[model samples]
Target: MNAPAGISTLDRVKIFSEITIKTFDILVIGGGIMGAGIALDAASRGLRVLLVEKQDFAAGTSSRSTKLIHGGLRYLKNFELGLVRTVARERKVLNRNAPHLVMPEPMLIPILKNASYGYWATKAGLTLYDLLGNVETPERHRMLDKTQTLAQEPLLNPEKLQGAGCFVEYRTDDGRLTMEVLKTAHTFGATCLNYCELRHFTYNEEKRITGAALQDKLTGKNYQIKATCVINATGPWSAKIMQQDQPEKLPELVHTKGVHLVVPFEKFPLKQAVYFDIPGGRMLFAIPRQGVTYFGTTDTPFTGNLEKPRVEKEDVAYLLAEVNKMFTGLDLKPGDVISSWAGVRVLLYEAGKKPSEISRKDEIFISASGLITVAGGKLTGYRKLAEQVVNKALEKYFPENRQPSGTAKIKLSGGDFENAAAVKGFLKSCQEIGQLHKYPSESLAYLVRNYGTNTKAVLKEACRLKAENLDPETRLLQAEICYTIQNEGVTSLSDFLIRRTGKLYFERGQIIAILPAVKAAFQKILTLGNGILANQESEFMEQFEAAVAFKNESKNAMVSA
Candidate 1:
């Protein structure tokens, strides 16, 4: 089957008309995975859904994750039974539904002597994790002896080897999967627009929310998007929206930052994904991703501003230090990192308690003003949380006849697919035909991971501007970058180079050096309103530079901050 094409400008105009001209049934604030999940769930249920984001889709924590779709084997120690079951079920759903994006991953937990969780404890956790999703998920966890463990992962630090345990989970491209949800929502006739900020709310005499007034962060245009119900699925920003609706009862969010670093895959030891202990027992991932070894994610409580959280210089050092401890010595350094990022997880805040100790459970607050605020949950359990939030909202509207959300059975974009190898062959054939002038073989593999079946569309976009016009390093023909601006809704170069193409995480310097080329592409593809190029380019470059530097910051600052 052929892949999908980009949204047409006429279609964009229609979406604009619906969002700005017509009042929607439900307005979802946030276009990350959870918000996109909510939009897909609600739209499938026959609701007129409108999803809005302050930044590009998956621009926040959703895109900047360890990119694992698992049953939360780590949470098994915390004894979060419900979360485990829900996430396990959701993981199964993701694997079954979005097969194109979510692929099975083998995780080797290298059990060391006298570790935080020993061999038996790790085995028990894996058993529970597998049981949560039932037999259909994957093979049950198995124990490996010292010699066998070394055989499975010769790269593992063997001095203190007490054997290793293997379990089944999943790996995915988080940003693309989130965008697939957005595309799925759009396919079901939902309205989604990025750079649309929720400035404030509208209230009736009874103080029930009528909707919200949004400002397009790009055009500085104001819009009053009226809706019967408004949902705050903004993850960490959920508390802020809740406060806006009920200013007196200020609720708190247990926001904790998680950071990940990118390095060449050869630097990280082991084959399958390795889930091991970190300093402070806070947890971190050193997963192989996108042909690069990306290690991450220390969970520490934060009390800083909710905007862009920087990955500190020390946090990077700390992550390198921890991996160094486990692997003995990979000789990784700050310079080895191509990119890093910090995202505030929306954990449930309990007064006088640390964020790490706080519950991973989600919360849904139905305000007296009819605003539905959802916050604090792991990504794996987003669909279940959405059902809970949507059900609460539906109760007010339909009362006794309210049915729960049935997104569990629904498929997202390119869901239930099995043609990755065939698609790769197709792409290879196209390149052989001189269809692509700029894309390199090395980068094409990564692009396949990022673009999925829609890769043809991107290639077609490049081909549209004459195949002979590309420079070395593929500088991605001028047409391809423009497709991102017009079709993928990239509001800035950072959104394009960082999340859209996803090069920033692996090769930002090479990408940035060709900014003038990208700018030229922007000029060619984006037929914007008059005189916005200079202003837009300056703004985009500023965002692009900041995004680049933000990743260069250390992991300890990311964790400690």
Candidate 2:
């Protein structure tokens, strides 16, 4: 595949050869947010770095988050103030750096008569939250009376609605955020490859860790890459990676599954995002994104396949029941769910505590063999976690000198806007460019918001693609697919639909309609044979069906792709 100029991993044949021949200061396993952040931090500070993911970047838990760069208001109840403070501060940093990816949005928390946090408690909590987060006045928490709350979001059950508390929370596309971070790392000289699996560890005479043997899943070839340090940043699969080195080590991670369901906006017409209470004092979020509304996150102990977490009949029923109970007379049913996603949270194991009660604070563990493993962190705190990992490696091994982290102010790729206001103006300009090519305004707006400064390249691709015998929608999809394949290291259809663009979860109908064009693009761009194309198409359909399959059908629809 022909990658955009300056992207290192666009040429996999070259990258594979480089991985085998060159030695790196740090080798990061897992290409999710943590590993990507670590790669960015280490590479930026002038370290030779190599990062490899068995799946596509953000294919795991990183892309499946609630997609909020929040301050962890619920953590306040657990008295995890430090965690909240750190993540709260990170929210601001991310919004400033990746303004196009992460933006501030108002979150409404209704105070009910029998709510988990009452009027006074909610007020005190939000006040403290603002102080802790250093929230600005305009976006600070505002106490809304019943009338005001109803006017803002009339979906709330009026029987016990005491009031509401509106505060700022950052919304983002988790997968895109991860990709941008990794791309920045690549620019800073990090060699990254997806579908590369770590086979085993190699050691010297002292029996200490030296390097790892990796198998390229794409080519079915094996290579040994030498590194001074190896860090395991795989979220749910962290323990599995650790045990490969020390088979006798006990489990340190507890896997908890969280499920989110998406329904059409008309079915559940929510004006704004809501954080409402459910049974057992738990809370669920109903956020409107694009054109659909998604609500989720049922946390429960999980012991299933880590690659693909199934959304069972009970999972759908639980969310629908809770959402319907919290809102007015809108009796939602299982069939109303357009699509859904389930991700496992790899948390630190705590004795005698429920899944939701476990602390979200991340912890680092170093084995005697010199393996570094990071576990149990929220998406908001990835940068800090990466800094800690890199600092630890430098201080312990390279005691002679250490490079201070410089990623605090580094702008991610495609996030070159000066501020949020500048982003809006860029969008308008992009709309004009798309209109000149006879493209729809909404499609161009979506592209600009997601691709940021890279929208120019996409628009150019759309122009070039006009020669092809394709519809407007197919041409647009092909353009976006071409760009991701060239720049984002997209190898499979699932990577483009699920992780790169989020079309599988948000726009299932369009995927079904445009899949023929998508498959054709992949086949031509990647030069895939008929067998490979068929296999990839089958795998993509399994995932597409799995997203909407509910009840007994869900079990049959479960796939390990």
Candidate 3:
């Protein structure tokens, strides 16, 4: 029952050689949140699992989410009671298991004179929401008067503000959560590889999938892996994988593009997260995090590159117009936007339904070739989706020794606290470490929150490199870079900046200042060549440009005019 040597990040070449010769009980494709969840569920149940991602983990839709682990209160408007209850209950499970990664945030829903729901109706809806989800907050839902609402969020448009409803929602770093899940799975003997692409599926004589042909993107070397079962948890790329099994079949999933914009808190400062009204019966969220106020998510159907979805000028203009209308005098422009992200939702294709109108419920599809595919679920419902997918795989392939999912009772990696209170105490202890090292309190707190119990390891690395005489900030950055490369399988610079650390999105302003230190850390620790370091730097820059592509597009358009 010994777990396979921890994650294989430090020596990937050795692990790659080993996995090619060893067979697994399950081979999971696409190491996003869903694949990570499936690997955790299966491995914890004593099943041998191998998970592969074409890019770095959480480099897709999983990283580019609105980043809320809520019960989907908005689903109540559509009367999707069951969906609300499932995700709400899962919300509590996530909070219980990963308190640092899934901290609670107070959400304010402003009631406008021309609002979709009146104050009373909003109250009743939340009442049902609480009853269904078993919401347990210090103070559940409260109805605030117009004066109280404005006092809480003075930036709201007060001309026609009726009131507001304050409730609890859990905020998360989606990419970090995915990494923690995969790491926990690795602890249970799951072999995971990022930057490993699946070329095609291998089949037995019965035409059932036996395994897959995979290629390491970094080494450009190919390997074949054998497994009894193969699950397509590829999220947006589910359709593409399914086509390999049945080329004549139509795509069962549709890609819906969601875009988010980040700006300095000084530009659009708010005390708490606000889910407010926009035109056309829709709404949006503006949440504050790490000195930035970020908001988004236009629900338009996407028909572009799946690997690289870009935020468009129209998408930014739409969000800006809506948010500006709701918050008086903000007058935020493209220049105010420091960074932005775009992700595609791989949803179940329902005829004649708009992207916004489609249900977020996940469905399992088993093709004639025994390829099991899961499509269309929310970020909060990932564990449940994984449980469902695992159960079906067990029921079909390994019926003799089926095991129930124990993920709910287990903590994710870096979330080994006794309880929520203990997590807070741990954060306090992390700040003491910062004080000892003369590190900024804010930076230390950020590390503790994102890395959870693993912050000690980061600090240990920082201590080891103290003789380098680097600035405290740069030293800390190098320590994080080292930690992620050795442990989190950070194969490239963008992976560290975007997913592992979240500096690219939340702390965009500091990226340029820290780039040199980041490159130095990677080079010193991994002995990367100058050419490799340059390529990684160029890739990171491309990611940064993608975040501001919309603004650049407008500038290009103006020049053409």
TM-score of 1: 0.89
Q: Whose TM-score is greatest here?
A: 3
lDDT of 2: 0.88
| CA lDDT, every model vs. true structure | 0.73, 0.88, 0.88
For 1-561, candidate 2 gives per-residue lDDT tens digits of: 012323423589888887878889899999999999999999988889999999889999988988888888988888899998999989988988889999997999999886668989999999999999888888889999999999999999989898999999999999999998988898888988899999999998887799999999988999998999999999999999999887787466799999999999899988999987677646799999988999989999999999999998888989999998889977998788888999999988889989989999899988888999999899999999999999998887766657799888988877888899999999998877777777888998788778888887877787888898677767888988889888888999999999989998889868877888999989888888999999998999999888877844644555532
Q: In candidate 3, how many Å is residue 203 off?
A: 0.8
Which model is ahead, 1 or 2, in terms of lDDT?
Answer: 2
| Model 2 lDDT at residue 260 | 96
Clashing pairs in 2: none
Tens digits of lDDT, candidate 3, 277-297? 676556799999989999988
Give lDDT tens digits, candidate 1, residues 1-561: 234534333254456656767878899999888898889888877888889998888988888778888787777767889888888878777766676677778878888887888888888877777788783634678899989887877767888778988878888877878877787777777888887899999988887889889887865878787899899888888878788888787566677888788877766645667778764556766787656788788777666765678777667778888888777568777777766667778876687766566778887778788888887777787778877777776777646545567677766654534444654575576466443365676555555555555655666665655555566444444655655555566755667776766667766557657777776666655654436767766765564555436444444456788
lDDT measured at residue 445 in model 3 versus the true structure, 0 to 100: 83
Winning model by lDDT: 3
Residue 235 error for model 2, in Å?
0.7
lDDT score at residue 87, model 2, on the 0-100 scale: 94
Estimate TM-scores for all models: 0.89, 0.96, 0.97
Error of 3 at 252 (Å): 2.8
Clashing pairs in 3: none
